[model samples]
Target: MAKLVDLTKKPYNLNADQIKWVEDTIAGMTDEEKVGQLFVNLFFPGSDEYSGNEFTNQEIVEKFHIGGARYKGQDSVQVQGLLNELQSASKIPLLVAANCDSGGDGATNDGTYIASGAQAEASGDTSVAYNAGYVSGREATALGVNTNFDPCVDILMNWRNTIVNTRAYGTNADSVIKYTNAYLEGLTQSEIIQCIKHWPGDGTEERDQHLVLGVNELSVDEWEDSFGRVYRNHIENGVEMIMAGHIALPEYQKALNPSLKDEDIMPATLAPELIQDLLKTKLDFNGMVITDAAHMLGMTSAMRREDYVPLSIAAGCDMFLFFNDIEEDTMFMMNGYKNGVITEERMTDALRRILGLKAKLNLHLKQAEGTLLKDKSELEVIGCEEHLEMGADAANKGITL
Candidate 1:
């Protein structure tokens, strides 16, 4: 009768009410089941059919019992079917999420209309960013996708950052702040939660963390200018979750360990001093603070030096995200937990954080004794006339060129 819930102790960290909820939920899990909540993987179900034979994903889903899956480029009906399958297989309701940050197109392509963040800037309408996020939220809801990870709040001070160039609203701090806040506002308005990201800001360094764990050499003041402005505003405006970037800041070096030089902590993902000390503690983000993607170069040490996840979670990441090739890394985390490197308390912490968000967003389905999501036609919510008009007007406002 020993269950995963038994592995987790009577949670005392949360309020009395929350602790009660955690206890009730934890009681249903086995040790392996509890460990699974530590992550959300973004698996591309190859060619999008993802049905009949879920192909290779079956192993990851069946063996791993993952907490959630953040899918990419999955068309509408296919997404519904896959989600239905996932929910049925899991003992607990799986926490399903998607990118959908710019527009819901981040997931459903044709199902959601697209908006160029650059175009929104050229349009000079801040509301455009808001509307874009709103449209993303509405479209995602139609397909049963809830958590929207977008409206990247990076200042994007470097025009050459290819990954961020168009995705970001613009180059100016004031404009980025104005538009990002509006974008978050719109996403929030639609009853969907927004995760404003690349926290501590992804703007200072020119390199993409996706390819390299880029370091920001700016002084504390300069670093603040590049990233702080917009993030401060994001927090003030109530963006619920903020993602930590892989980029490093030389200025916060001493905080990482009053002794080690900048070379020792090139990537923030693995450094608790930088992310936990500087970000979570100093910034006081009481909400969820998640990692960018564990599989990215930012979190991965060189193939020879690869040892970051244990330290990353200990650093204060509430959740770790993985895009693809998930098994290897997920195994590492699970093994770490099994070995005591990652405590059950830590795994439970992530579960509580992720589940807490699901609850907050009202993503858990309602009034459904039976309605095959596939049998439904909710995909029509995206790009409908009302959304398109709102998007067009907002795009016009935020776009500059």
Candidate 2:
């Protein structure tokens, strides 16, 4: 049996009432609702081009009972209005997220484009990175985003790596840690939860996971000193979430089980040794673990969707990212649960952590107070002059001769 998590402990820190809300909410859910809680679907408010299958936001919440939705719109007003609609439609408060890595512009066209990881590092000031995160939080919250996927912590050891070269803070662990801490500190001040990314680390391989599988070929001791050190610091610093990339960490997998063959190795999203053992147990990360994105070739090519869909959650990921086909993927998760592929213990564990995240955000409190979203007046900061000037200042400082 999996050991039960102490909701009252660190990370979650749910009070008695909040704990009750988490437990009672899960207890009241149907099997379908429970299954739905495992996914974070994509949304493009402005166009049908990215709408997954033309399912409206209300339909998604009603039909899927999804735990979260990531906004992919490019307009500020559209994104905010759509997000408010999504939150109002759901029975449970949705964990709305935006890719705020560069800045608020990651979510909307009118948002601030503060600085890229490379630019922030080049500025020679951690405060530049801090402002980037703070401005991202301010604009994102103004647009109804409660979660941010930013501060790509993957150490850029391989310069040829396409995915994280410019996105990463620096080439070494110490530099990456310094800027990531500053960024998260600024984001934390805004009360929007932070999700650091690409676990087991990326940027060690030249290939992009979106196009093909990428491996972090570091030896156990080498990994422990570099990428492992980076992750340890973030986990200890109280990051609310971590995004498990499709990249493989073969060395650590082999160290844990000597007899395991090369073919047995899988991405962090489907490997129990990595997710359950290494991340959850060895690293002692009590917060939620969400997959990078399910549609990437690195994840899809490894196996058929039917097999890997359930294996992801069973492997210990708390939430799956994006839907390839809404109806089919929803059924796949439902069938996986019904067939006992995802055991009751595992299901409950995932649910508790998912709800624990919402409870930590005090979504329940905000919902009851009818203040889950800020007023339209708050949208003034989306691309205001002040934030634009901050972005310009950071850019000028980051300029190199």
Candidate 3:
């Protein structure tokens, strides 16, 4: 049997009862439930139809028992209503997440559109970053979302990097670190889980991962001083989650193992050296590692879905980001487990981290209390005057002379 992770550890910090609950819950989960925990499906707000996929969010939960979901931004009332239904449908509490990098409006329709990353970088003030996280966390959580994917830490080194240019703070490591730390502080105060994204760094390449396979071409020492510096600081500061991107850091991979051919170098999401050795072992991140969306060509082009789907989980990513097709992907995952692509040990480790995150969020307690969704009164904070004013001030300060 795989060794059980100590739930009372730093990131999780679950008490004895909470630990027991997490263990007991894991022990009781069926095989389907276990596999489902490895996926975080994407859903749209307006309709049951999305991207030609007809399955409703409820169907995903009922059929696959998915552990988490990411939803598009909508008005507070509509967002909350749909989330409540998904929460009620699942046996386990779902980790509802939103892309709050721009601000709370990234999650909720009426939320404050605080400074963009470029704006925040231009302002050159860490407090702007802090409020971006604080205000985003406040509005997002008030609408029942538990995870915030913000403070895109990619260094804007290549000016041609359009995808992450406006989403990043700046080109300096010290500046990125300072702003990221401040953002973490602000998000923590609002009591929401923070997940830093595009791991092993981005912006070194001008290509978008969505359209092509992106690579971070820095040498080992160069990366260590730059992107490595940023990640090391965040990991040390107790960031609870990371989103592994499809970008590759081949130099580091080769340094870890000289045998790895150039063709064998995969994106961080599908690379054991990057995810397991570099991120988990070297960096010592105990938090959950999720893939950046699964459907992106950055990932899909690497290999067939059947191979990469399970390979993502096997590579140490605890959760796959989105589904190509619910049934087909689930079948691929199950087949991987059955065919031995995803070993039992790897599966257990992924489950432990996934459940550990949920437990850390106190989902178990809220599930029992039937209080997953806050009342509509909390919606008042969505675009409150105070937040709007702060956002406007931040925006003006970010304008370059």
Candidate 4:
């Protein structure tokens, strides 16, 4: 069995006020509200006007009390307006997140479009990578996106890894670490909570996790030297969160549990040994561990629909990303907790970590101050002359050919 980390100790070391806020906030939450905190629902900025979905964003916010939201493909102004509306409607402040990997352009149409990792590496200028993160972080923060799912630190060891080629820093560990660290530095400077993704790495597999379960076939020692090294370095540097991929580490699984059948070995996202033991204990990662989209075939295909919430919670995941039906999923989690499949202790632990992250981001203070993205000047920075010039400069310098 994977040893669990002490959940009481504050990883981010919240001060007394923040600690009190987290405790009080969690205490005030009902079971449904607590379960909702574990989910990061998909938020389409312009979807409110479409009339296709029965529940509007505000309705969902009121219904679920969702902790955060993941956004994609909206203009800067639209994103800002929608986020402000959602945040205002929520009982607790929402942690707005986006896949702002390439820059804010990755999530929004009007934001600065920067070069990919391949292009940045081709420039032979690591500064371009840093600038890419900075521009992305800056624009994301200005637009009320507090969390960014970016700086994909996966080492592309497989030549046939199509999904992560441009997304990842490089094929080599050293280059990936250097560029990733530099990029994280820039991103963190803007105070946007950055999440280093596809933990235990992702590029070794020829298959994409989006379609099927991806496996990293490296031995324990090989992983220690490559993916492990990059993740360890970042964890030590105080990364806010780590997104565990659907990829399986067979060697680690077999070594940890020799009695288990081959069919019983699961992906890192649903394996306690991988998450609670390997990641939490061995890696000494004190930050939150979120799963990749639960709606993906990589996750859903491996387990029954009802097992998703309970199994993932047992696997020590702090948050679940992108369920097919937010309302149904939220109800499933609530029912799981009530039925004792997901223990209250586990739920509280997850809530503490989630709330701790929110406290670290000072969401409580921001909520009280009513200062979240209220500044017109900060909003003006989105796709401004200076940012656009920076993006163009990065593109010019980052031409691969």
Q: Each prediction's TM-score against the native? A: 0.84, 0.97, 0.97, 0.95
- Candidate 1 vs candidate 4: the lDDT winner is 4
lDDT of 1 at 146: 59
Q: How close is candidate 4 to the true structure, as a TM-score?
A: 0.95
**In candidate 3, what are the lDDT values of residues 43-130, reduced to their tens digit?**
7776675566677777878889999988886688999888888898889888888888867888887889887778877888878888
Q: Report the CA-based lDDT of candidate 4 relative to the real structure.
A: 0.82
lDDT of 2: 0.88
Q: Cα deviation in Å at residue 253, candidate 1?
A: 3.1
Model 2 / residue 4 / CA error / Å: 4.3
Candidate 1 stretches greater than 4 Å from native: 1-19, 45-59, 302-306, 323-327, 362-375, 394-401
- Global lDDT of each candidate: 0.64, 0.88, 0.85, 0.82
Candidate that beats the other on lDDT, 2 or 3, i.e. the better one: 2
Model 1 worst lDDT window (10 residues): 1-10
Highest TM-score: which candidate? 2
lDDT of 3: 0.85
Model 1 scores a C-alpha lDDT of 0.64
Candidate 4 lDDT score at position 46: 82
How many collisions per candidate?
20, 0, 0, 0
Q: What is the Cα root-mean-square deviation between model 1 and the actual structure? A: 5.2
**Model 2 shows how many backbone clashes?**
0
The segments of candidate 3 whose C-alpha lies over 4 angstroms from its true place after superposition are 1-6, 51-53
Summarize candidate 4's per-residue lDDT along 180-271 as a digit string, tens digits.
Answer: 88888888879878799897788997998889988899999899999989988898888878898988898978887787677887888898
